[model samples]
Target chain A: MPLSSRPVSRRTTLAAAPLLALAGCRWGPAEDGDEPAAEPSNAVPDEQQVKAALQAIADADAFVKDVSADHVGLAEPLAALTALHTAHQALIAKEGDTGTTVRMGTPTRATAALKAVRRRELGLQRTLTKLAGEVSSGELARTLAAMAAGVAQQVALLPETAKDADA
Target chain B: MTGTDALQTTLAAEHAAVWIYGVLGGQTSQSSQPALYDAVTTAYVTHRSRRDQLVRWVRDADEVPVAAEVAYELPNAARTPAELKAIGLQVEQRCAAAYADLVGRTTEDERAWGVNALVESAVRQLDFDGDPTDLPGIDA
Candidate 1:
């Protein structure tokens, strides 16, 4: 027999299987007719994602925490909004940009919606910041809720954000 | 939104914080009440540092984060240290929760920052509220 026609080696076959496994991930059960399993829907949005957004917002809050008493001032909500637009843009894009995968699939539309919400949040952040500066009567308290709510509402729309993000 | 989505939420929170501190500081500065001025100024410095870090964070992410304006107005007359501190505490609590909200919602790689943020805000609130036990990293 020609050298080219050598018999199959056990070591080569064993090596091949592991390499194949390494190259691709398998979803679902092996017995399910060889196709990967389908992913479940609506796992609650990750808390970490929410936490990060809040943390970023907190950093913004930290700035204004004492502004009211400082006798200093600014009107930069619009600027804040613009910066937010620039800052998180990648995460906003990445959460949805990748093709479907296990964890990566989670953010889906929620990411985009948050992108919108975050943009709004920036506006609100500034609006509220300015309001905080101008805070005199209890009127600020009254108006603050609406602005905060607007941001929260957008955050509240995370489910929607996630949907489009996943879709 | 993903971890970054939650991160985005923090942007507004930090904005709120910056506003609160700025308001309190300016009001106190105008009054020039010694004790109140010191406290409010301290608070403002804290907030300003926090704000700058946030801005840097946003920038590090390669996003177009906003810049603080030349000035903001004071809503009411913040004439006392107590009043300014109250404002700080209130806003800090809110910011803490905001970060906490994220901690509860996200997972994996994003959780670390969220938790760190929660700790930061909670500790800050503790300082403002004068209850060390209210959060971690404070002694009895």
Candidate 2:
């Protein structure tokens, strides 16, 4: 689901305000004789990126469910892919939750669904990397990077590659 | 940590991986454990290639790449194929952690390389009989 659809708490918005201020600071000129403001020691995580990650997990769960219902042969690989998504969602949710609202999309055929998930995994990889760049917390940034790597590995294990592996 | 520092850490981890794989392949029985031996051989080549790439990256950035130790203490003697797999798995996990930190520290080309390294480490986790983790490097 989009961030707009999720009900972000008032506290969450307030918590993320410093990052918004940082974004705005990028536009303004420095005042004369004043040193640049020091970075906050405890900066908020990037809200939009967190929301998008949560959405990606929900999408993966729904798609895997759809594809698994129709294709038994694809089940094992899909399960592993789904597990990765689930684990990502759990970590992100624990960090700063804007509640997940499942927005289900139409499922394609087995091959197509695998391709679709691969595309989604690639998207997540990019998003997580961008998010890693934006966040101030070293720990959080490393976690995001690790998750991105997990997605990349999942992308490599798509249906076409699975067939290649068997061959 | 700074990008250079992270890169150095990764270089060290890769060095350790290359060393461990060499010891692992030397000690493990190739005739009795063909598949395990083959996997170790492939892993050794991959780590050697990565170690070389890391050296070039550090050199390109005008930084001194961390040198491999004369020897590393093995977690165990790794007398069996299973023990060798365990050692391989541990080294890959350490590499994943190092590369994950590098991903956060570096940008543009270096960051891209770090991402690929992290991914390769995670995939190698599977080859070593480790499960797919939600977070490869992170404890939580």
- Candidate 2 accuracy as TM-score: 0.69
Once model 2 is optimally superposed onto the true structure by TM-score, how far is the C-alpha of residue B119 displaced, in angstroms? 0.9
| Model 1: per-residue Cα lDDT over B1-140, one tens digit each | 33344455555556666776767766665445675566556656765665576567667777766544455443345666666667666665555544443443344333334444444454454445444221211111
Q: Lowest-scoring 10 consecutive residues by lDDT in candidate 1 chain B? A: B131-140
Q: TM-score, each model? A: 0.35, 0.69
The Cα local distance difference test for each model comes to 0.39, 0.67
lDDT by residue (A33-132, candidate 2, tens digit) is 2222223667665667677666666665666765666666677777887777766666666444545445445344556656666776677778777776
* Candidate 1's iRMSD: 19.6
Top lDDT model: 2
Model 1 Cα lDDT, one tens digit per residue, A72-154: 12212223432332332222222322211111111123344245444545554444333322322222221222233333322
